[model samples]
Structure formats: structure tokens, C-alpha cells
Target: MSTVKQLIPHDQALLVTGSLNAMEDDRGHDDRSLIHPVQIVLDGDVINCSCFDSLGELGVSALVVVQKDPLVTYITTGADLIELSIENDGSAQVRRIEIPALKDVHEMSLLDGVLWLANTGYDEAVAIDLDEKCVVKRIVLGKFRGKIRASLPSFTGNDIQAVDRYHCNQVFQDINGKLCALVHHTSGKQLLKRIARKVIKSQGDGGVVDLDTGQAVSLSLKGPHSVRCVNGDYWVCDSGSRMLNVYDATWRLKNRLPTHGWGRGADFSKHHGLYYVGISAERKRYRDRPDYNDRNLIEVFKTDDGELLGEIPIVDGIEQINNVYLLQRGVVETLLGLKLSSWV
Candidate 1:
């Protein structure tokens, strides 16, 4: 049996994004089905699950809590965006915005009121003006063949051909306040050509790039997913290597911690003085050994010493976790509006 430690404070909760698992048996079921993408709130032993019923058949990738007073959250589901607002009484309201240009959208970062989305399929980072609800800018990356436009007057999902050249998965604000993107496979276009010829297998060719200058900031990574700046240090989830890499302000690797599974989502909780890293079960194509049922878990580590504290299994029909965010429990409670029941 798995035991959970009471590391999280009572005042805070973790808002987690569980990506859709198409491998599950109940793929085409209704909204109540657990195989679809979901937003989960973890408060100590209690777990609150929320599924988007209005938005049908979309995979929830990443989300950001833009406001806390009314508990407003923006979630990325494939090419669509969901605006979720929670009232004081705990009722939830959802607004879906369709952006056809975005494909395989992943992590997002908010800077100066603009939301930067990693449009993975198109190998671009798209900037959306929240108030205006329009695509303000698009930063093309990694051997994209499509024509670059200075500005998009309207959302055209079909204007550009979708290709996952770089597999650009995450976009976040660096310590210097500049936007940076984590490309899962930096040389993805070359790798795709090699794959067509059946010559070589995909290897670790991932790196981080500064969106402003369109230059690589960090290199020699394997399937990098998320990046966060904590106390002047950059933490990256080197997923393909199943390692948590820490880099100094100069982008020098300071430490590397081995996570048993494929490391993906990551966040630091200042209130708890710890770091939470999400790991998913290794895919069959990448695994050298048999799969482990208990591989999908969250690894908690001490911030100061990088000590492995404990592991929290993500069960209850959640097959994979994409992102993790630590927020106030009061806010989540208000947003969920659910009575505390039993431990997960």
C-alpha cells in the first residue's frame, strides 16, 4: 500500500493537470469518464477532480491560475483554450476559445498580461493578448517551413500546415523576465528525416531557447518538458533521461537528480519549502524493462538539500500528470466547492 506524507500545508493545495490517456479502455465515453483530461486539486489526502463537460473530446495539456480572488484559470486543450472562473460560492463557469493555428499546445506562461503558448505541432510560440482575445505574435522555431506572419488578424487554425519538428513543449519566463521555450528534440527536423529512412532512433537532442532572441540558451538535454526558476536556479525536467536537472543563473548545470520515471511537470512550493516533480510511466517504446504500475507519481524534494522526501502515487483513473501548480487551499476549495470526503 502507498502512504502519503502530510508535507502540504492545510492552507495550500496543488492544482494538477492530468493529460488525456487515449490508451485507456473508456476513450469514447461521456464527460463523466475518467479517461479524458482532467484538472485535479490535491489538498493533503483529499483530491478534487474536475472534467470539462462543455468542451468535448479535448486533451488538457497545461494551465495557469491567472487570478485567485475569484479563482480564474486558463487551460490549454489541444488547439482550444478554456477560461474557467469560480465564483465565491464555488460554482464554476467555463468559456472555450478556439484557435485553429495552435496544435498540440503545451505549457504556457503569462507575462505582462499576455499568455505565451507553446504551439508544439507548428514549432512556434504563440502570444495571445488576454484582454483582446487575439493572437498578437508568433515566434517560429526549429526548421519550420511555413511562412511567418507579422501579425494574425484572425484565428486561422488551417492556414499553416502542422508539423512537430521541434516538439516544442514548454514556454516559461526565465529569471531575467524573458520568455524561454523547452524543445523536446532540438534537432527534430533532422531526426524526422532520419526516421523516414529508418536509419537512427530518436535521441536526446533537446534544449532551451530564448524567445526574444530566438537563440538556444541551454543545450544537451533529453526530452526536456518544464522549466522553473527558483531562488536564482533553473529547474528542468529532462524527461527522456528521467532526470531532474538544476541549472544556475548562468545556465550551468549545478545538480542532477534521477527520477525513476519520465519526469515531466515540475513546480516549487514556497509555502512548503519543497519542490514537486511529476513523473509518468515510461512509454513502451522507450522502456528497456517491463512497465511498473506505480510509476506515475509526484516526487517531493527538499529545496535546500535536494533531498527526496516522499512519493505520491497518482491513481484514481488518472494515468498521467502533465503539470503541477501549488495554490492556496482556500482558493481551491472555493473553486471546487466540494465537501471534504476521504483521502485519495
Candidate 2:
């Protein structure tokens, strides 16, 4: 058994991993490289594991475990939605659902049998019927409304105008059972200002947005992602500041731990006592930062105090990590050499 497996409790069955660019190449320009962007069964300690090797195209982002018997992962590949099912025998099945209205889909979450997509390219959070695979309704991200018109080619009547102003990327059901999201930035102008060096941290505008009531509360975050409600408190990856911001149940900032890399994926397991976080590689866009030399990796931290526990570096073949999830053994299973795992 590998060190990672040994460190993790034996009760843990599998590990789910997602990467933005699977290949160790120039990701911004290369799109043809169909490297396996998702990995399963972390059987080794050196970050070397068996993974599904193909998913059509790259730019793969978020992953979620919807149902287990035959393990299922709803993954986002750019604007595409992929359903990968892994069975008990390790065979696999892949289904490509056509969502004409989807534009630049990002981190998603399944709630109440509905899949909520963070349509970043459209500046909206859309809910789709799980059974019909068709869009049911979409809530325009409040900040982006009136800023730009929706121009998505597949966007029909009643759909919000497509204009990416806030760059909303993650959507999930809060602990209160309300829909919420983590917007990358509050305004495109603020984003541009940061790129232009006119500001220091884009005003730390990327905060939590209440999708249900169309209200937003600023937590003074910078380039945040992976906003999740755990144990009734909100934990978010403040990516720009390289920190994890934890808020109390009443939405008060309680803890801000300095994570030593560009933080992205943030998740907590039912196993308790720890949190899993994905620290991405410092690519060209991050060339100006001090940790630009840091390798893409995932770190385990103490959930109570945000103290670092361990890390898994993506050196063997992978490059950039987009998300990380904890899978309980026998909950969901994946094949050895396939991205299309069986729905066992």
C-alpha cells in the first residue's frame, strides 16, 4: 500500500481527482491533447494512480459524485457535460448530454435531483432537470444583470443575456438549503484593472452570491472558488490571496489561514477532522507571484484550525488541478484504464 493510502483511514475506499489541464504542456494554447483529466483509486503514494485517460477535450474543471452503486461523476469539460459511470466489475460507461444552453460550465452540484451549473460564460446559475437533462430554470447572477446582454448561440427566449461580468464559477446548495455561488470577480472592469496593475487585489470582490434571492454578500475575498457550507459554516478558497477564508454560521469571518499556493478546490469529508484542498500550479498568468515556482498539488489540512497536514504533488504526469473530492470505498467505483467507468 502507498503512503497516501496508509495515511488515510482504511475505511476510505477511493480518491477522486480533477485537473484543469491534464498534460504538462502549455494549456492555454493546447486543446487537442486528450489526456485523462480525472483520476480514481489513488493506489500509490507518489501521486501516481490509475485514471480514465480520455474525455474528448481538455479544460476539464469540476467533478461531483451524484450516486454510488454504479459510481457516477458529473464532470464539466468546458461547455460540455459528461456523465461517467463506473460499475462494480470495473467496466465503464460514458454519456454525453447535449445542453445547448450551457456556456462555459464550471463547478456544479446536484441538489434535490437537479443539477445546478455555474454558467460562467453566461453569467448565470442554471438548474437542469436530472431526468430530462433539459434546463428547468436559470437565475441571473445579480451583479451581472444589466451589465451585459446574453449572447450565447444556444440561448433561447427567457434565458438571461450572455455577458460574463462577474465570472461566476461555482454553484452549490448552502447549509441552509439555499442556492449559492462563488463569483470569480464582481465586475469585469475590476478584473481588467487587476490585469492592468491598477489595483492590488481586484478589490477582493469575488465573494459568495445568494442565487435564490439574487442577493450578494461580500466577504472581502479575492479570486475565490470552491465556496462550500460545511457544518453550518462557509469555507471558501480565497485563491488570489492564497488563503482559506472560513466564516461562521452567521456569515462572520472567523478564520483566515494562509495556504502557501494558489488555492482552488476546497472540500471536507464525512470522515471528519480534516479538509482537502487543491493548490494549482503557478502558470503564465501567475508568473508575477512569489509562488509561481510552486508545483501543482493538493494538501490536507486540519478542518478545525486550517493547519497543514500533508500534500500530494502532481509531478509524475499531471499538471494543473481543478478540483479534489473524497470518495468513500464501495460508494463509487472506477475502472483501471478508462474515463468512462461503469455505473456499478
Candidate 3:
């Protein structure tokens, strides 16, 4: 039995898909290695294998995973894909596709056969075709607020302020289909003052920018990572400083929950009628490449009173996961382990 597990509500029980990976260098050898790319699915009552083969390294760096009908895509920093073909027997084969123009694609989404990706290194968003593995369109938010693509978040739960920092944050889509964007600006004096608080500064603009109209708006936060759409509202998680900021669908910061306990990725849990955030290590800093197998675990908390709920300890030395979308249905487990040609 796996000791590592996630916590679910009373109506929604916990399930272990065991869809995961092995730390390539389990022995703590001098040489850094990689285990075959792996993933898993944990349905309410069933846990099955995934249909993916190509462990495109991009998905790991971006910290992204999403399953669309008939397809599952992983986007890493290299802006690549670990494509798979789902078979009748629930097995999968991997297909490699490289995406250009993305310096570093962090997060991705699939809607209406279109793959929406955020370029973490660049201030842009790209949509691609899964079948053809080609670029369809691109949205370049030149100098949008500070690395607009660090970690794009997608919300399937209630509006509990999922994230607060630039990374692992989400973008919202309103009724008109226009994207909610951060309008940004900066003052050298103001920035220098904020530096005292250890604020993560953006290379793009100093403030938030509008997505469609490209307007500048005043936003407040210690740090804002990802944005998620929940029940016609938006949840913002600022993991850098451990705060959850709320926003209306119109892109206004409305409510805030201080780091009552811990939260990396937060969402409103319908089953419990409260907001929940998946908490993990704040972020690790290695002095001289510290040992990998020391301590790596994850936790959960309530967004309402900031109560500690559960803990998940993974063996892969993964310490930077903010949220996990646990649905009533199981995972998109069409893909299996890969038969790689050679990862480069």
C-alpha cells in the first residue's frame, strides 16, 4: 500500500491512483539521472494506468498536467509534449512533438480541440492542435505583469482563491469569452520600497494588464501566483507570501485570507462548503545541491479558517505542487509508461 495519499471530503473519499514516477537517482548517486516519465489516475473507486508514453521533459518543469477527451498533453519548460494514443485495452503509446516560439511553456488547457498554453519564460499564450502537433494561434501579452505564464492554473471547483503568486496562478474566462488579464505598471521608488518585503518582481511590467482591452489596473497583494475560475468567481493564491486573494469575474481583488495555516494551491470544496488549499514545502533552496532524499511532503488546509486537514508525502522528491484536482470521476488514464527513443 502507498503511504503517500491525498485527503478528500466526507462525501468525496480519498483514492490512490498510484499514477506516479520513481526518483531516477534513488540511491543518491553523484550522477543525476531520470526515471522513465510516469503518471497515474485515481478515480473515486478505481485507480488505473495512464495512456501516455513520451515523458516529454517539458511537463515536469511547467508543473502541468491536463486531460482532454481522447488526448492527454504535458507541457514542460522546453515547450514540448508527451502525446499518447489511447487504445481499446486501456493502453497507450507516446508521440513526441516539439512546440516552437515558447521559450518556456508552464501550463496548458484544452477547450474545443484547442490547447491553450502559457509561455512561462515569455509573456504569451499559444494554442496548438493535438493531432497535427502544430501551432494554431498565439496571444502575446508583451510585458504583461511579470512573467504572465509562470504557472497557469485551471479551476474546476468553487472560488476559494486558488493561488496568489505569479506561478501556478490561473487565468479567467468571462461570459463574453474575453480573458481576464493583469494590467501592470511600475514606479522605481515604489518597487524599491516593496523590495524590503521580499516581493517577487516581474521582468515584464510593474503592474497588471487587461487581457482583451489591454488596460492597466491597480492590484494589491504580497505575491500572486496563479488564477482559477470558480463558480463565476476567481481564486488567486500568493504562495510566495502565503496568502489567498479573491477576485470577481471582472478581475477585481475582493477578499483575502492570510496564511492562517498553509496553502500553495487553494480551491473551494463543494462537498465541504469551504475553501481548500493544497500545501507543500514553501520552496527549497539548496546551498550546494543538497541531498534529494531528505524530506518532501504535502499538506492541505481550509481556506475558511485556515485549518489543517491532511498531508501527502510523495517519494519522488517532488516538493512544489500547489493543488491537485480531485474529481468524482477517475483520472485520464489512457496513457501508459513510455518506450523512449532517447530523451534529449
Sliding window of 10 residues with minimal summed lDDT for model 3? 184-193
Quote each prediction's TM-score.
0.81, 0.80, 0.61
Against the true structure, candidate 3 has what lDDT? 0.43
lDDT by residue for model 2 over 224-271, one digit each (tens)?
A: 888877777788888878888889876799998777677877667745
The alpha-carbon root-mean-square deviation between model 3 and the true structure, to one decimal in Å, is 9.6
How are the candidates ranked when ordered by lDDT, highest leading? 1, 2, 3
Q: Between prediction 2 and prediction 3, which has the larger lDDT?
A: 2
For every candidate in turn, the CA RMSD to the true structure comes to 7.7, 7.1, 9.6
Tens digits of per-residue lDDT, candidate 1, 162-183, equal 2346678877787888777787
lDDT of 3 by residue, 181-271 (tens): 4322221111221333343333222234446654544454344545565656666555544566666766676676554323444445655
Model 3 spans with C-alpha error above 4 angstroms: 1-6, 9-71, 74-78, 143-171, 182-208, 250-254, 260-276, 283-308, 327-329, 332-344
Top candidate (TM-score): 1
